[model samples]
Target: MNKVKLAEGVYYVGAVDWNLRDFHGYNTPGGVTYNAYLIVDEKVCLIDNVKAPFAGELIERISEIIDPAKIDYVVTNHVEPDHSGSLPVIMAKAPNAKVVLTEQGKSGIMKHYQTNYDFMIVKEGDVLALGRNKLHFLPLPMVHWPDSMATYLDGEQILFSNDAFGQHVCSSMRFDDEVDIDQVIYEAAKYYANILMPFGKLITKALGKTGQLPVRMIAPSHGVVWRKYIPQILAKYEEWSSGLTKDKVIIVYDTMWGSTDQMARRILDGVAAAGVTAKLYKMSVSTRSEIIAEILEAKAILIGSSTINNGMLPTVGGLLLYLKGLRPMNKLGAGFGAYGWGGGAQQNMEELLKAAGVAVQPGLAIKWVPDAAELDRCFQFGLEFGKSVLAANK
Candidate 1:
């Protein structure tokens, strides 16, 4: 890729990952961009690096702007492998460059690579003058990782946000406006839901610092840069951080003999009948990350599964375990399922729901296939749950 200029003295030196389908535990079907930026000033600065495999690509891009040996400062904004995996390669090329990062970042990098390169440890509010522009560092501890930070360029008024406002998508376009706006926004929301939802308060705190800056462009470490819809994305982060949600419900389930499926569908009908929006997903066929994204803005969720070996299905357990760690905010949840003999799925689910920080109530458990009367009762159960959600939201 040729150097895509962000400003007169800055250019995009990142590599797009087109074959990646999963990032950590989350699904990233459209792939993602490991964005790195290079600034040509009195002291040449490289913002971040791509995945280890993309190190050569990054060098090729940097060579387009200036010889890799001309780099003076290599800014490691995040210590995650995707952003810092190429640090060793870059440092090898730029023999005079100092790796500038937070203390925690330095420790992590030292442990990860065991390299004793020249390290410049920076902290929040620290500034480095690059001749025409001054780079300001803002340490954001545990926004996702303790080693994460953002770089702000004073003269250009750009925030090189490492992970905040990032989307897991690889597109030919570099700027937000150049891509499909709706799709970019959707991917951004998914990224927030999956990666940063648990760190909402930390993000809100970080935003307080960033909100005070005079930012003209938000060049994040992933996906396209945000310039045209900065206000829109900031508004979304605000709403999400504040735990805002619409009157939407999600019914996710996995059925062995189709009995639990019947209950979930009836519940969806009740949710619709109660004048609320609802989404239904079968865990056996659905991606857990995608369903979690849907749950991000939902007021409530009704999870179901068929009993096997006196416990909920493995898929349901996996989802519950994932939610427990993510700890989605401000959600009312419950369980419903059908079992053949001794039932345990509903109880198992409710316990995990409580552990996940959801305000869970008693779950509805049915034995064997539902008859007409049982199905009616299931509908009533869903209707009552839906009504309860509406009332709570009000």
Candidate 2:
């Protein structure tokens, strides 16, 4: 394989897992990339490492350019296993390479591996001189992880932005310009919605600190290296980090038989008639990550379910649980559902929605199967909710 260079001496030595289908519980249909860069300056620095299983591939890529033993420093931006799981393998190859990371990162690595190495603890504004080029460290704790940080190469003007701008995409092509921009952006958005949404405040802080850098390229620890779409991605990060939303609504539900399904379709119709972008997802069929991505920019999220055991179905319960953990910002929420006897689905949904910090709006509950009148009422409720979304967004 040809070495992918970010600059004259800096090279991308990452490993791609095209077969990966899921990340923890989040769906990753497009797979993932564990991006690491090898910068062959006077010090010969390796910026990050890939997942442990891909250690050989990462080493092979490094060997193609230079000897692994010559690597003077192995910089870890995050202690996430996917990024640091291969540390032992890489350290074995370069026995003398000093491990570089934040203090918390050092603790994480030690606890994770149950082994210790020569660790260089760094903090914000710390610089690692690598010949003519220097790597500047910015400690951004809890942007996604307590150990998370970003490294900026001064002369090359590339920000190795750890997990901040990452997307879970596996492609042979390395940079944003080489792939379909739309797909990259979509995956990037999904990444943010799932992984970074809860850290909006910290991300805003991360963006503020990194925004001061003269960033010519953003090379993250996952997905494509961003060179052509820096401004677009930065704008999106700013928007998402600021909890901005669009005039769109997302309706997600789990159906027992077909009554709640009917209500969902009718709600979609009403939302469309109200002149707003709307998306519908049957929770049983759709990936939670995908639906969450839609909810990322949506003005409101409407959850529905067929009442089961006087509460929501497991899938609806699961999605709400995940949403509450993520705690998406700047959104309204409502619930609608069908029940044969009791009315607990919508109430439970709204309660979780409130816990997720969503502004609650009045919801709809229909008994048994919806008759024409009840269905119309559902539509009218949707229309009013859509109008409410418009008003709230404005």
Write down the TM-score of every candidate: 0.99, 0.98
Q: Write the per-residue lDDT of candidate 2 for residues 77-124, one digit (tens) a residue.
A: 999989998999999999998999999999999999998999999999
RMSD of each: 0.8, 0.9
Off by over 4 Å in 1: none
Residue 327 Cα positional deviation in candidate 1, in Å, after optimal superposition: 0.5
**Looking at model 1, which ten-residue stretch has the lowest summed lDDT?**
1-10
Candidate 2 positional error at 82, Å: 0.5
Off by over 4 Å in 2: none
